[model samples]
Target: MAEFLQRVQSVVWNRKLIRTAKGHYLGLGPEKTEVGDGTDGKPVYTLVGEAYVHGKMDGEAIDFQVENQILVEKFELE
Candidate 1:
């Protein structure tokens, strides 16, 4: 999985949000994000950046991750 990880990482780093539809461990989402207090709850949206992946695995598995993503600033129903 090392090669798989490397390929994935490269794609993530360039973006502001990393999205993994099926294999999305450290994938894309708003819940796992860490918004700097200075950001002031703007609900950051990105096309690539660092992300969080939590399903049923430990942290040591993928110690470091880097990927890109498609982000949405907000979801509204009007």
Candidate 2:
């Protein structure tokens, strides 16, 4: 699971967001990803970063967090 999360985080960090509204956009982090359990007994992965609002378009910069995970009936390793 740790290895899987690392791979996923690497892919996400290499990507960037381009669309914008009023100069406000989300910027992903200096932080990495981790794994946990979800509400339905499934694996839940989380990624956290900074949220930026530019030029008085909104409030100050703040923490931005998101998750990516999968549910499985059985855990397997290749």
Candidate 3:
């Protein structure tokens, strides 16, 4: 799963849009860094970003705010 995430990350790097099998699109938003504690009880730095989705609506693009992670989990690159 980590490998798949890495692949997806590489493909979507620099906020490039990628189309999925389900006719939806995926792209990175922006880079975000946060400080948090890790499993070792030490401060851990985390890099995070928002993933966006756009669904096709009657051949038009409709932006969707992803409230469920399952939508992204089902993405399969062909």
Candidate 4:
């Protein structure tokens, strides 16, 4: 691992996004999706989720907000 980092992408001293192992995770999108409970009761709001990891890098970041079970706002990465 040390030798590989020295030859490949190195973020710091010896840290790198390796290739020997594969990893992934679900990431929040730039929009906030919301789901509402339409039951025969009180009005309820639930935040919904869309696609997992976007078609970007592994360390991309996003922001989202939900209100009344609906996407209220979204923020872009600076």
Task: Identify the leading candidate in terms of TM-score.
Answer: 3
**Comparison by TM-score, 1 against 3, better one:** 3
Candidate 3 Cα errors over 4 Å, as ranges:
16-53, 62-78
User: Model 2 off-target regions past 4 Å?
Assistant: 18-78
Candidate number that wins on lDDT, 1 or 4: 1
Of the candidates numbered 2 and 4, which has the greater TM-score value? 2
Candidate 1 lDDT, 1-78, residue by residue in tens = 999999988765544443344545544434344434224555554433334545524644434332234343446543
Off by over 4 Å in 4: 1-45, 62-78
Candidate 4 global lDDT? 0.36
lDDT of 2 by residue, 1-78 (tens): 999999987756644443243335443323332222123454553435443223323423212211223333455444
Worst 10-residue lDDT window for candidate 4 reads 13-22
Tell me how many clashing residue pairs each candidate has: 14, 0, 0, 0
lDDT of 4 by residue, 1-78 (tens): 888887554323332222211334333332343222224355444433333343334433322222234454444443
lDDT of the candidates, in the order given: 0.47, 0.40, 0.46, 0.36
C-alpha lDDT (0 to 100) for residue 52 of candidate 1: 52
Q: Go through the candidates in order and give the C-alpha RMSD of each one to the true structure.
A: 13.0, 15.4, 14.8, 13.7
Better of 2 and 3 by TM-score: 3
lDDT of 1: 0.47
Least accurate 10 contiguous residues by lDDT in model 2 = 59-68
Ranking by lDDT: 1, 3, 2, 4
Tens digits of per-residue lDDT for model 3 on 1-78?
999999987866666343444545543344442222123453443435554545444434322434332243233333
Candidates 2 and 3: which is better by lDDT?
3
lDDT at position 7, candidate 2: 90
